[model samples]
Every structure is written in C-alpha cells, then in structure tokens.
Target: EKSSHLSAALLGEDCEISPEQLYELLQYAALGKHHNAAQPSWCHIYHQSRLAGVVVIVLHEMSQLHFYKFYLQFKHLRKVFRHRFTLPPPSANFLASLCGEGSGLNPQGTAPGLISTGAECIPKSSGLQCDPIIRKYGKEKRGLTSYTLTSEELRKNDYPMRDSPGCKGYMYTECDLQRTDSSPLFGLDCEMCLTARGNEVVRVSLVDAEGQCLLNELVKPESVIVNYCTRYSGVTRKMLLPVKTRLPDIQTRLKKILPHDAVLVGHSLNADLQALQMIHPSVIDTSLLFARNEGRRFKLKFLAKAVLGKEIQCKQRLGHDPAEDARAALELAQFFIKKGPVKILQRALKDVPLSTFSIIQFSLDPEYVASHRLVGFCEKVRNKLTDMLTIYAGPFEEDFCLKSVKKEFGKCGPIQSLTVVTETYQPYVCIQYGVLEAAQLAVESLNGAEVAGSCVKVQRPITAATLDCDVLIKELELDIENEGVIYVAGIKKSLTETDLQEEFSPLKDLETLFLPKDLQSGKHSTCCFLKFQKSQSAADALEAINGWAVKGSTLRSRHALASGHLWRWIWQMNHSSEKQGGNSLSEKMAPLSDSITASHLGTSLNRDILHKKELSAAVSSIATPQQLVMVPAAGGSVVLLHDNTFIISQGEKTGSDVLSAAQDGTKHHIFYQKKKYTDSTASGGFLMLFKGK
Candidate 1:
C-alpha cells in the first residue's frame, strides 16, 4: 500500500512515485529538471511504449485548467534542457541566434554570407540558383524512370523505378509548359507499411517551398496489410482502421494538385514514387544533391542538422513525423541554394570548434522573473508536508451520526483516528489515515459519497496545528538552537546556577546552563537546564545522569525544548554577529530580553535572569554570521533573494550559487555555477539571457 500512488500507478511500471516524492514530481513536470535529492525524472518514465517520453500534465493557471504535453528528452538527445539556467520572455529571440537562425552572434548582428550593400547576395543561375546542383547529379532521363537515377544506378541503390515490361498499373504526372524552376518547390516524403505484395504507401506528406504543409494524408494499402511498422512509419493498426483513403485516390489528387513542372523535392524520392506507383519528371533528390565521397549519401535528418542547424527525427518521438521530415528536407535543399556549398562548409567547420560553447541565454521581464521566484518559494513549502496523512470532511447535517460516517468512508482504507468536532456552528469530522495512500484514496473516492442521506465533501484538513506540525517537530531534532542543551527536573530549591554548573561541568565540555529563579523571592526553582559544548557530550550526560539521585530525589534529564526564551536567544546570538555602526546585535539583545522578562515576572516565575546573562555571554563568544535570514522556498528549501540576485541552498548542509544582472544597458544575463559538491541542486554551468527593462 505504501508503494501505491493514485497518479503514478495509472502510468504502469515505468513510473512509481511515492507520497514523499510528490514535490520532486511536480518540480520535474514544471521545470523539466531533476530534483537535487532524486534521480532524473526521465529515468523512471521514458521507457513506456504508450507514453513515448511524453507525459500530459494538468496544470491550473490563470483560474483555468490546461493540459500541457511535456516531452522528456533522453540524456543523449541534445543539450537544450540539460543545462541549469533561467530565461525571461524578452530575450526569446536570442535562442534563435544560438540555434543559428538569428544575427545575435554574427558580426555586427549581420547574417553570414557575402554581404553587398549591407544585404546578403547570392549568384543567380537561370533564375533558379540550382545550376551547380543540376550539373553534379546527372540530368533527368527520358525513359520510364523520369528522375535523376540512371538504370544502372537505380538497380545498385534498390530504387523503385518500374522501367521493364511488367509495369502495367503505373501512371505518369501531367506536364505544363508554364511551370519553370521558379515554380514553388514542393518537398515530398512518404511512410510505407509492409503489405503482402510489397512495401505500400501508408502516409504521405508534402510541403511547399515556404515549408507550409500542402498535403498530409494516411492511405490504406490495396494488398492485405502485414506489418504496420509503427516504429519507423508511425502508423498503427488502430490509426489505419478508421482511414478509408487508398493509394489511387491519393495519386489522382497529387496529379491535379501539383503545378505540372513544379520542382518535386525529397530525399531518395525514387522510393516514394515507386511506393505510389507513379512517375513524375522535374524532381530533386537531396540524397543526390548533397552527395558525399564515393557516392556515400548521409541521412536527410543528419544533413539537415549539420547544414541547417535544425534537429529532426529525434528518438524521443514515437515515430517520424513525415511533415517534419519533409520540412527539414525542403529547408536543407533551400539552404544549399541560398548559401551554396562553399559557405555551408565554412559554417559547419566554424560551428564544430564552437560546439563546446553551449549556454542557452534569454532575456526575461521583471514580472516574469518575480513570478518564477514565487513559484519556487511555494514549491518548498509544499515539500515539507508531503507526508501528512490527515483529511477533513464536513459541515454535515447536525443529526449525522458518527457510525454512518465511519461506515461510508471506512470502505476506502484503514482509518487511524476519527474525531467528531461540533464546537463550531457547523459540525465536521477529522480523519487521519494509517498511510498516505489511504488518506488520498479517501479524499478522492469518498469526497461526494453520501453519509446519513447527505452528501459530504472530503479534503485535506487546514488547521494551525497541522500547518505548524513540521516546524514544531523540527524543534526536537538536533539543530543549532537545541544541539547541546539538556533539561533536568527534581532539583532541590537551594541549588543555584553556579552549583548546577559545577555539578555537571566535569561530565563534559560545559558551556553555560540555565536555572530559572522566582523574581519575588529570588529563590531557585526545582528544575534547571544544561548547555554543553558538543551535542555528543550533552547526549552522553543525558543518558548517564538521567536517573541519578540528586538530593535524595530521582532526577529526570532529557533534551531541552527548542522553543521558548532559550531558542530565541540562541537564534538571535547566531544572527547578531554583524555590527551596525559600531555595536554588534548581541550587545542589543541583553536589555531587550531583560525588560520583557521583568514585565512577565508576575505571570510566570520561571523566567531566568542570572543564568540567561551567562548563556548570552557564552553564545556571543562563538563566531556567527553578521546578518542572516532564511526563507523557505519550494519543497522546503532555503533561498536568499535580494535586489536582482537570487541564491538557493540545498539546506544547511550544502548550497548552489546563481548570479543574474542587467548588463550593457541592452541585454539581461543570468549565470549559474553548480559547485562540484554533494547535496547541490545540480552540477554544471550555464549562461542565460533575459529581456532588459
């Protein structure tokens, strides 16, 4: 039951999130980053076949619920989200430049090319600028194969060109004399599923020269379907079951939609033409256009990324999107025409040496930055109470019996405690479950369940006690305030502060101890507190002398409560190290505590005067921060924010540094450096950009 989570269990074995891990879960979903204390979120959920590295999360923002699809990029996919940095909206265009599209990194912010009259200029060739490409890949043949590959080349490369006597069902594209090289270049890519006869076209995507998709359709094969080829073709049985369009229908549409001499462009387009059982002249194959040494052809995706700096056909996708592939090929061909081979080679060579300089930068608006800070702050607070297992449901009818409520909700899971509260105007019941899952299950399943013929709403309880439970429990743990302090009771009324210090000094490295005395009689109380130099020494004293007899009475020794005057004094001493003007804060704490203690003497005689002065002196002797304030951010994390700078620490044990500023009066920048240390947010360096004011 402890292993079960309502949302995670639905995702199958690829994900298993416990209640305590909910904070990190939301953080990963929101920020696309791994938690400092948890493994990368992709490690758990990326392997699911149904999800395909993409998870849909329901987010509530602007008073509306929105469904967002977050893709978890594999570790080796790219360095886009791997780095640690923050960006604001204004500097979004900077990302385009880093990806080699804009002029941000270019000299004088100019596009890379042969600049003439302050604008890029390219040599023209018959108004097409493709004369060099045509001269290299052979001229289009006039026989059955109207494309570039010759008879011998077609046989060697396994291209599907039906040029022999057995070609009966083939068709040819119509020709129009009005079409020329300047006609809109259309990029074509097809996906095939293995049919009993052979590989048949299942999906076809075509894009115009402007990268706008003109035709994207899924077709059912004429022959009996065999393998859907979901991995490469991205076609599943469920998808094609509803598709009624067939190959002949698609062929007729393409023949009419094409502008006769429209330059049909693709990568290894002969295969696509063969799959469609049609012949088209005036076609450009990027495979042959960007030819390699000894007829070696690179993949269309590889060529697109290398030449155009565009990433396509990533492994994270369920299968290739023919539209995206067609667009990539079109852009690749367009780039070769615009920049030519020589500039392309130079840019590729220049980019190789600068590949190590991978830092995503963007400018952010001030409001956007502040909003992110608030989000982080809220996440920290949510992380602290992830383990709470209580819920409240209420304002039920006054006559609603407790038995009826228990019988209704107890069906969900085991209940630890159920209390009926009727002190307020409306009555309600508080329920604490034995496990977090049970509590969650009760809230989700039994929220609107009827009890005593009346509907009841179940939800997490909101109360002062529940909200402060973690902080109150944290006081009992060994922290700076309660590290070396022990409480003792059953002391004789005659014992003074010096006498108790002398009695316990030999036991360990004694700092100072506190013994409250009555202000009216100035007599010591029956209990006193002890402070040691080390936590271990205090623990040892507590264990060794807890039951020891003191003045013929058994002494009750335990760790001191971290709240009350002692904790406040220790906290002040730690922060009072910094001196304002000429005096330290410790110098200012004595009179303040003394005046408060004197005014409260009538209410409680347990306010110590002599011992507090000694403890304050001992604490001042130790080194502490000059000024410090810790605010809890998302997931109960400590963050320091001042002006334009933000710093976040893992906890008291470790920290990471992030620096940001508006620089040069035009650009905003953020730089993060994660130290090579454990318990840090992450380990890496990033340079970011934001929009400036």
Candidate 2:
C-alpha cells in the first residue's frame, strides 16, 4: 500500500489519500501488529516516527546496541525526523500517539533504565549515563573546550548515528586541550528548514565580534530534492542538486574555521547554532545586547536603522551580504561594549522618573564632552561683537584665529584681543579682530584663503538690527527704479546731471530732473529724478542707464544721494534733448501737436514759426561759435553758408542754390533765398526766388 501511494505521488496520479491521511496510513502500517510480527522478542521499541518516505523505527536490542529499519518509500522523511528528534531526546510517547496508541501503554513491556553509552551511540533506556570522556573534554572551562582529532581518529570515530559503524561525531580528548589567554568567541548564522530544501544551505552566513555576514553557499538537503523559492534566494534546484556535501561535513568545516574559545555572536544566534547542530555554551547575541523590551526582539534592519543610520535587508537582490551583516553586528556589539551592559540594562528599566533622571545624568557625563564643547563654542560666537569680523583657521591649530588676525593686522596696531573659539564641528578656529579696520583688512585679505584644503570665510558678525535692515533693504531694492542712482566715490564726480541726461535721453521723455543732495547741508538736493509721462518709459529709462557712472570729487561717495539740486538742473537744461524716446525727429515730434509751446525754451520764439525759428536758432548756436560754419542736414535737410559768400540750400523736392560775392574783404555778404508763392487757384501767384550778387 505504501509503495502504491509513493508511486501515485511520484506519477502525479490522483491518490485519494490526503497528506494527513497518507501520513496516518503510513504511521499505522509501520507500527501495526502485522508489521511487528516479524520482529524478535528482545527488540525493544526505541523510537518511531513518520518521516522521510517511511515509518522510522529504532529498536534497542541490548547494551551498546541499536537496530534501525527504514522503509525506502519514506527514506527522506526518516532522515529529517531523525535529525529533529534524536539530538534532544524526543518524548517517549510522541511516536506512540502518532501510531494511534495511548501514551499509558508500555509498548516495550519493560521499565526504562540508565545505560552508559558513548557520544557515538544511542542510549537504550531513559536512564542513560553521561559519557565521562565527553563530560571531561566537552565541559566548557574558562570559556574554552578542545575538540581536536587526527585524520585517522576522526575516520575511526562514529558521529551522526553514534552507534553507526561509519558515522563519526566530533572528537575531543583531555590531552588535546590547549589553554590560551585569548577570550573565547564565535560567529553564527543559519540556513533553516526552509533554506535547507533539496539539501542546500541557501542562506549561509557568519556573525562575529565585528558583525554578521549573510554568505552565499549551496547545500544539498538529504530530504527534499527541489527548491520552491528560487526567485527569492537566487539559488536554483539545478545549481544545488549536484553539491552533495552533507550538513555534518559543512558543520565540521565551520567548526574548524571558527576559534574554539570564541563565543558565538549574532542577532539570534541560538537558532543558527541549533540548525547547524553546534552545541556551544558561550554566545553573545546582539539582540540581547540591544533589546529594548522583555527580550531582544527587534529586526536586524530596524536595529541598523535606529542605531547605525543605515538600511539593510535580506530581501534585496544581492541578498544580505554576510560580510556586511557580520560587520554591522560587530559594530552593534562594540557599541554596547562601549556604552556598558549595565547602563543599557538600566535604560531598560520601566521606572519613568528613574529613567528620566538616568538619561539626564548620562547626558551630563564627561563622555558628552564633544557636544558640550560645541555648545560652548557656539555661545562664544554668539556673544561676539557685531562690528567685528571673525575668521576661522584650520582645526587642531591652537590660537589659529588669534594668530591669523595678528599676522594679518598686527602691523597696523595692537589688536584689542583675538578670541579663538573651538568646538565639536570639524576643526575650526574663530579669530575676532579688535577693531572694524582690522576686521575689514582681515576680511578683504582672508575671505577665500585656503587653509588645509578648506576655504575660510571672514564672516562679519550678524545682529538683529543688521539682519533686519539687510532684509528690508534687499526687499526694497528688488523693485529699485534707478540702479544708476547708486554710485561709488571716484566714479560719481565724473557723472554730472548733464552727462546723465545726454546718456539717457534716448530712453524716454525727460519731463523733470534732479541731482544728488549735498550731505553737508543735510538736504534732499543732490541726486536727480526725471519723471517720464509713463511708468513704462521710466522702466525703460532705468534699464538704459543700468551701467551709467557717477563722478565724485570726494574719497567717499554716498550712493544714496537725494534729488533736485542746482548742478542737476543746469546739466539737464543744457545737455538734455527732446529726442528721448525715438530715433527720428518726426517720430519723436509726432506725439506733439503741430503747434505747441516749448516751456523750457531759451528763446522768445513764436509758436507758429517755432520749427523755422528753432532751426535758425540751432544753426546760429553752432555757427556763432565757429569762424566759418556749415549747417548740414538742418531740420532734416542739408543747408550751407560760407561767411559773407552765399546761403546754399537743398529742399526735399525743388533743387535750388544761391551764391553771393563778398561786399568787402572784412565783411561777409548776407544772402537770402525766397521761393515764389502760389495761391490756391494755382495761377503762379509766386515764383521761386534766389537773391545773390
């Protein structure tokens, strides 16, 4: 029946039996009277379990003796059951209950008695004597135990199934024990039942005094033949199937690598040790070391995040690297070591008032010197004078601030005092120069000076008033209409109002102008403001004069000068032009009525004849200043006049010229050209005229 079920399961046939039912059926058949009928009378039921592909049954015949019968169908389950049950002796009634027998029944029909069995053999009775050799060598003394054996001795000793002829357990003898001054330590990580599928150690790792490393290794399980969760571990059944090294072999290798006196270090080291079947007395679990509650229960990632400010996880693609994990664990251990186990335990106490007091005390301890030093330094910096500038020199250099200040400003005068402030932040020394001059010199010279790869800023002390004023000015300046109003000392003297008007005339119509006020008079009378007809005109005007200069006579020039002064007025009237917004006179004049008064005119010109009179005035203005003058392109048309010679003219349409000979060598002729006028009747009422001699 078992064979049939195994066949059905292997062939994927519809076996009517459920897994539980199949287990029961197998259990019944293995322990049933029909199967036990062939057994000898002296064979006492030692152990039984439904495991692998069979009913695992062990019979103790006599002293130092045990017989094992395994059904091949469940051979795999048997090994698994044996591993789980035999290590720590399983309950005597566990198998009986599984076989549908009452725990009260004595199946072997004999009272249990102690039997002396070596580590290699299974005890026949419940009262088994501990092996003296094992007790003497395996007992942990000074946190160390010796388990050394020669290759020949190891081959001769029986281990896994202690009584089995070929199996050998770890061997140790008193003669092999070596005492060392070094502290005992070990690292532990586990490949659990889930990870052990198909006999593979999918999750192998190590933990040490340093940390835990989730190493990558493939192990072949003796029971299962395939891996179901390959996507997670990146280990496939094909990759693991070929590697047949048993768990004992892997355990032996680990034991050889780890120091004998080393205490296991890990997050949950017990689980790992148990899985690997390593029996060690000394272990240091970081979980216990960092436990915040009843026991160490925090996840590894959580501990890493809270304590170390790092994120780590086993679910990552590369998985948890064992080396890094080991290192992290070790760091955590060291942190606890430095903090002291007693302090951590004290923190774990539940008394609210006591905990708070303890916390306060801890914070005030000398161990917090770095933090206190930083605070003190910041206080010193805060109390520094606002007018002074502070420069930070390289860290670890004493009196760096004072030294730098003296070195830079010592020649000028004796410094009041240079204060050096040192604190927690990477090394920096603050040097406060005594006076503003000294500070200014230091700032100008040392602001961006590099010392030991770090650039230092000579920072001016900030105060509430200064900071607020700066903020307000920055806000006001955001919409400053005139950047040209601001000036430097040497540049302001050369920039009179006339120069500004001449330069900015192309920007807008200059309706009014002002100049900067004199500081001595304490009046708003120096700077100028030329208001345009529109805000757009003003904006354009300001944009045009963004880079204009101001000429100043004094060493220091006030950039913020008041407007509407005499110098500015005279400059604007003499140097300003009506051609402010446009390039062509026609375009500029188009906005004005054909007949308009020039309010600021320098002459008594009639409104109707203003254009002709202004043209004559402009010509006279230029001509009167020169010996012989020619007014080319007057009023947008060419005009010429040689002294006492002729008045040559070229109109837009009618081409005409006039010439006059000199009346006297000392006197020049006054020639005039008059064109003939015609009436509306077009009857040639006037003719073109040129008067010349």
Best candidate, TM-score: 1
C-alpha root-mean-square deviation, each candidate: 26.9, 39.1
Query: What are the runs in model 2 whose C-alpha is more than 4 Å off?
Result: 1-184, 193-200, 207-216, 225-234, 241-244, 342-693
Q: On residues 445-529, what C-alpha lDDT tens digit does candidate 1 reach at each position?
A: 6688777567888877565435654443443343344567676665676766666776776787766666654334665556666
Residue 147's C-alpha lDDT in candidate 1?
A: 33
Which structure among the candidates has the greatest lDDT? Answer: 1
Instruction: Give the clash count for each candidate.
Output: 18, 70
* lDDT (tens digit, per residue) of candidate 2 on 587-628: 221221101111111111111122343333323323122232
Residue 97 displacement in candidate 2 (angstroms): 47
RMSD of 2: 39.1
